[model samples]
Target chain A: MDIKEFVAQSIGQWRSQRSAHHLAFGHFEAIRSEIAIEVVADHDPAVIELCKAHDIDPGSAVAPFRMRWEGQSDWDEEEEVKGTCILVPVPDPGQANRGKLLRDRGYAETMAAAGDYYLTADGTFVLTTAYDRAAAEEKIWFINPNVRCRVSLIKTSAGSGVVTASFSSEIRQEIRQEIRQAS
Target chain B: MDIKEFVAQSIGQWRSQRSAHHLAFGHFEAIRSEIAIEVVADHDPAVIELCKAHDIDPGSAVAPFRMRWEGQSDWDEEEEVKGTCILVPVPDPGQANRGKLLRDRGYAETMAAAGDYYLTADGTFVLTTAYDRAAAEEKIWFINPNVRCRVSLIKTSAGSGVVTASFSSEIRQEIRQEIRQAS
Candidate 1:
């Protein structure tokens, strides 16, 4: 517990509040790399062998990795696009200061809410925001991990009422998976 | 400013702190059927009539409506392959809320660094967190929107910064595109 008492007891301030609660919106350099290491420190086999320096399959990649080209058609211009997103998170010690204080007060009340929420991508943690990336990658390859969450939203559609969304859901923690890949 | 005093002084229960904020976390059948309104109204032409209910080209979907979603995925369980992201402001919005209270304690410290931050979409502000849909979308698009953050890496082999984690992050509204819908 040294590295300055684990950066004075929060390892780079809880890995920058769990990398600012998973890039708090989108594309913060694909997840990161200006070199700040110790991102929650996962199981620590040297942080899962330095997340293999960056293929990041913390078992089957999708715990706290994150990615998005934003389906580039000029994905709103982060230099027109190249590719980036790493964000590793595990070795929880104040879990990045409580995931950057619950996503900056839940993103300023959805920036005053009306018609903004609708992100898409899936291979884990449930999904279906739509545009149908092959039915959201076949529900991210049969995912269930006991109903934890990364993405799942409907938010008021109404033929019979719809408004869903999820994340860690206050520690019910079931999220199971088994995928293997190591060299 | 009527609707029950605009939900009493503009829906003042969201209590993360505010100076100019808005909200959305999901499971939003309009949050028990919309009532609160006015942390700054007029911006809600119903988010430009739901961007005219996605006719597309609202200048590239307004960068997914300004970005915010953190699903946290076990494949997202029944929520399913859920992923979403869009967080702008590497820096901006100032005076006194101190980067909106360090992005409101870094959005509950990125949902307690991805433990559980759920809702599953409704009127919108969707999340749940562990880091999948691109690290649950870097917990709001690469933090420090107030603070807490990760990723600095600078392209290595091709793996550079491998990513495929997703959960959820859907937020939009930073202004700048009103070219009357890019003309």
Candidate 2:
């Protein structure tokens, strides 16, 4: 499927199983969560706000999505946590598979971020983000229409150019409901 | 070139520049280092020791290589550090591009690790390791005979299945001698 088609199919409820690996400490943890993804109009208030937060023109945005995540991880087993984020995609005229991924609230940090994203020839969606002290590259691909997988790498810098912390993760995603249920 | 030939070509003194991103804290760091890689026979004493440490039969190993790294990162700028590791490749009967990667010292933790290694259809060498509390996946590919690039992800688990830390990195590699002489 094309890049736009792939993004369109991502709008739904999904169950995700994730395995996280810590590099410095040599540790592994598993996390199970659910996310609800909804498509929003380019001019939606949330989309507009996200663009404003990242200093991008709202008119330049092509597609916007709203995401809500709820789950329990190894670190937070007692409480179910929830988070909301807005993703705005700004096209790059120079490249078909490349664009800017603007986020109102970033994955690990709450600050807004503008990250680079591209779709591979094989249809894998890849994103790379650089924060003040951290950076991440994530790859997401569909095994089928109903199943998806993600692999990510994150690094935290200490002083000079040394890295004090790092982590790797693998995530599996499945549609929450089947065709019959949706119908 | 074939996988064996590729490994053979990796022997040399090379320089690497790495950028690390910390996911949770939103930090970024840079690292500069040099590595000297040498090929060792499968029956070498170091290879035998590595196999014994990991409970792998030495007879099954295909190639063994030694690596020495020296450099200064942002975290430790005062002193030049040196570290060494051994890499042993054991063939996987099931898959042509897949094999076992046995190491004397792992990337983050010091304990011996036997990671899964595979060559992608595009000729990228990928390695995935699982440790007691951490896990890592690394991808390395050559841009040419003297240039290469690497990407990696590491995750640290806190408890149960929760990940408390994560990092991602991108590295560029080049031949050391040619650049030095040019300068």
Candidate achieving the largest TM-score: 2
Candidate 1 Cα outliers beyond 4 Å, as residue runs: A1-70, A74-82, A90-183, B1-6, B11-183
> Against the true structure, candidate 2 has what lDDT?
0.65
For each candidate, the DockQ is 0.03, 0.06
TM-score of each model, paired residue for residue: 0.19, 0.52
Instruction: Provide the global lDDT of candidate 1 against the true structure.
Output: 0.22
Query: What is the per-residue lDDT of model 2 for residues A35-138, given as tens digits with 9 covering 90 to 100?
Result: 78888898788888878877778987876888898877666689776799888888787566788999888876788888899776657687888889887766
Cα lDDT tens digits for candidate 1, A76-152: 33443223333333232433211110010112122111111122333222222222111111111112222112222
How does model 2 score by TM-score? 0.52
Chain B TM-score, candidates in order:
0.17, 0.83
